[model samples]
Target: MDKSWIDWADWCSKPYRAKLEDFLNFAYVNRDPSSRIYCPCRKCENRKFFEKVIVRQHLHGNGFWKKYKIWDKHGESRDGADSLHRDEMFMGSDDYMEEDMVKVLNGWTDKSFKDLLDICNESMPEGVNLPNSYYQAQKLTEDLGFTYNTVDACPNSCMLFRNEDINLDQCLICKASRWKEDGCSLVSDLGPGKRKAAKQARYFPLKPRLQRLFMSSKIATLMRWHAEKRTDDGVFRHPADSLAWKDFDKKHPSFSGDIRNVRLGLASDGFNPFRTMNIVHSTWPVILVPYNLPPMMLMKQPFIYLSVLIDGPKGPGDKIDVYLQPLIEELKELWDEGIETFDASSNQMFQMHAALLWTINDFPAYANLSGWNTKGEYACPSCNSETASIWLPNGKKFSYGSSRRFLPYDHKYRKDPRSFNGLREYRRSPTTLSGVDLLTQLQSNGILTEYRREDLQTRQMMGLEKPEKDPLKKRKHNWKKKSIFFELPYWKDNLIRHNLDVMHIEKNVCDNVLETILGVAGKSKDNISSRRDLELMGIREQYHVKRRESGSEYFDPADFEMNNDGKDKFLIALSETRMPDGSASHIARRVRLKDRSISGLKSHDNHILLQQLIPLSIRSSLPKKVVEGLIDLGKFFKVLCSKLNCAADLEEARSRIVVTLCDLEKIFPPSFFDVMEHLPIHLVQEALIAGAVQFRWMYPIERCGE
Candidate 1:
């Protein structure tokens, strides 16, 4: 952060600075406790000595890198010109330059650059070593063609001040100045103006970055793994092969025509870099991931490319659409005109077309992007049909409230005596088949409709008319109009346009399970009602019960409460125990629930809950059927997370999730549904199509907000 470090150092010695006697006294005063100063001469080199005589002798002589001729031969040196020539000689040649660069690249750091020239002066090289400065190394890297594509943007979350608007002085939307008016000359002068300048986000075009990926032959070939190397076998190896994908492909034949065209998945979320959870200010980064890679390499961070940073003191929220304008414009171009790209593997330049296959995000982000109400009962994205919900005793209502009725249409829970009598018999009618049809149905609602059907008014005309009082209520009435996704010409199909982030979903489900079990109010601990239910399930004695002063029983569930096995006993047990599929298993790592932090339970903890702990450890305590159902769910998640060659197991896993969701009454307590309705729509749609087992899971964006 300091500018002084960037200044170049002078190599020549000062003329007549001090006579030999004065220099000797000055050097003696600066000597260490051992009465010796370090010698910089070629022979006496940088070594601490007990004798002051040795240090003085070295200073009078020439060092390998530091020539003494500059000082001693000052009068005969053509006013330091001949001494300067000799100084160059002391510096090494091109051969040693290569070795220096290798060291620079491998051991480069902030301090390394600052001390580079100093290190060269200290080095006693046998051969000529070039005196390479920090700037020279930077110039070398630039000559090697290292560059980044950067575009300026308005400090406010307005349009990019790029292209035709590059010369504009102010933003069109917010009227914010394109550049800071008060240009500070010194670091001391930098205050509010510099802070404002810092807020101006930079846009890095993803097109060039994607092209660069193809420059590396090893990575270039891996980019085509999904299309060429992966075995299809009619399974869901990638989203391209999913049922939703195939449906979209069927609807738009021309778009899916080129198998070689790149497919991209977009993802974005707001977060506070400061790690202060309650802070309202957050930075949002829009990221694009190439889905052409295999499952193992897909989610890796290095492969994830940043398209833009939405600089902020506050999150963009619903207004995230404004920041996405540039991305959307680029995407439209990529989809339509394509780009001329060089492929290293094929060793040729080709026209590469890229499409945003889908977006991956948590529920809140998905809702912000898709304009779907994830909080409502009709939250199911696949089927816009009405879902069953019930008013609970807690003065709140929940969908799939009754566990007995939580199953698939044909599931036996519909007849189970414990299920809501006659309630399970209610059947819902089907809704529209496509997003277009769904939009039509929503538009027919009188409150949202700008004009009557008989009036024969267009939507544009409706917008011109003054709305009735209570505009906020009207806006609330029609969430569809607020959604930008419906307007995108490319992403017409709502079902497959956005994807559920698998990471968030698994983390959310795990949090719910752990919260209820651990009895932590805000974390993955079990709620009071869930604990009471567990008591009713006939395992109350597993915990410790204390007699209070009032002679009433006080339950302290710590005895049975789940804790992290500090020694990883659970992991050992899981590894040794035979799984239901008769496979020997090794979990990635041991998850410790007890090691709680401000973020509540971590991903690894949730992983353990779903994969090993729930399936293997809690079998005896819970009902046999419930244990089996949980194990089934866990296995499905495990398969989904795995990197399999074929989609056979993936499809089967998806189907099992739907079935497991249907049997939730047997698997989990009723309180879980209170949180289920708010899950992202992608999970709901995927479940409806693949068999209703998977959609019941929740997304974990709230964890980030916390």
Candidate 2:
């Protein structure tokens, strides 16, 4: 080989070998003890004290026995092996790096080709990396840098790992230790207490819908702190500052309280009664359905989400990240049918506050004339007269002069006999008026055109109107209560989680609930058998305990609904009422004959009667006590009904009649009439209506009057 080619082969054939040999040569040339000053450790000194041949023999494991143990007091891991309480900080698997790797290699030059640049760079570019990106990369490198955030003060709230677009609450207790450095959270000094607590209650795979609920809860609190309210004077007139919502949200501050949390409990045990009823009714945008939650979840709808915000010092962590997707998808389904969600924020709960103050319950304003007031009209207080629209409501109509921008309109109240000063005494009049139109048009026999006929008819009808009635005349109907409805559309995806359904609580369900119960009953008992939330709701009992400290009633589904497949089968009502409504008259005992056939009755006209048989059993793969409890529902409802208020005849309540079967392998008392206490899902009709009517109450009159 030529000289140039020979040198090239030597240079290319060895890479790792070259690097190692080069370092070895450098070490040999400077063989003094001081030359091993790269490290002051004993390990480095031992290697330096020995010559190259001895070191090479020891490293190659060629019968050069010097196998002394090296103790890692700090438990530092250099290679990829992970120790129990230590971390692997370096990639130390480079010991097998091959030497002479270039000769047979086709890509040696290409692999290190970065050593060749399109153009030479004499110096580094200034500020090549951005501060934000650099810091962001650094933030994710260490566990010491990690922090857990709380969604709310409640322990039941789920937790998240970091800040994101959504808010998924992470268990504050488990994450307390990660936030000590921020001076924002009490991350240290808590003997792993929070970690164990978090382990006891944690949600995996954060969901989006739940995340939004966490943030929404925070917003609800701020809204209650600031809202404009006025007393209801029978006259329906309010002061200027009292009414301002019409245009305020447009320029709201950064801390605007947009999320309104008109909260009720959100758990199966301490569930909200209002939302439970809505789920039973299959109301659009109201029944929280998931993206693809099975029909089973649709039956036992979950309750309202609780929105809470911590008021004091942050107890343990950074801002809790919570997921909000699961809930959002459910809301979208209602729009398919054109439904809406209600802004049941704290602002709507004014009646209670008003009652305490002994002020009017509500008040509103009614302006008659509004327009860009010209020379004969008044100018806008904010902008000059040129820009505003001019229109008139009934009361102030008389003072309003003609303007090019004004449009006249009237409501039923405008014709009512209520006078506010002279505001009530106005008439629709523009002085240049002469109503009598006399038309003379000769009809052409061949074709009396459409325009000519229309003109003749208009002229003939100019003076026609049912004569005006006196606005001062009082109308009795005004005092009578009239039914009004408003449309509210909200979507939810919490169908299966509602404790009432899973636990077999029927007090809040109506006819619709009964129907759903029966439908589920029609299926095999092997389905829907495993829901632990059911046991907490009293579908099964483990010795009833009265816990005064927590204000709770306890039951265990494990005692009954448990089946072989690991499902809790609570008792279910076999019979159902015919009317299919919340009314007490609709309650019917679902009859599952001893032969396992569910029964009900229908008259000769095909109208369902009070009795019949349907083959029904509470079967579930999960095998929980709640599923088994369905078998003895009559006894359960009787005991439950005995404790609840008498809404209607318990015998007719369809919701009470449908049930589950739990506790085949256990024994318990029938029903405790002495301590027969049951709770209602919703305490007020108005609140229940609001939850159920979300998008369905589309009638404007049903909504609260502004």
My TM-score estimates for the predictions, one after another, are 0.61, 0.18
Q: Residues 138-257, candidate 1, lDDT per residue (tens digit)?
A: 454333333333555555444555667766666665566665555544322465345234245546676777777786667888877756787656644455555665575676677667
Candidate No. with top lDDT: 1
Tens digits of per-residue lDDT for model 2, 1-706: 0112212223324552354344345334423322221211224533333445544333333221123222121232223232323311111111111211331233444323323221112231221111122233223232222222332223322233333512323334333322233245443334444422221112221123332222233333432432333223321121111112212222233212332312111211112223444443210111221211111221122322222222222221111112222222222332222122222232132111000000010010000000111121222211122222222221211121111111133433233221111123134422211111100101111111111223223322542111123121132111111000001121011111111111122321222122333333433221122222222324333343435567754433323323323211212333333554542233244344333333332211011221121113344422345334433443433333231222233323323322121122122222110000111211111112111111111121112110
lDDT of 1 at 271: 73
User: Model 1: number of clashes?
Assistant: 20
Q: How close is each model in CA RMSD to the real structure?
A: 15.3, 30.5
- Angstrom error at residue 217, model 1: 4.2
Residue 343 of model 2 has an lDDT of 23
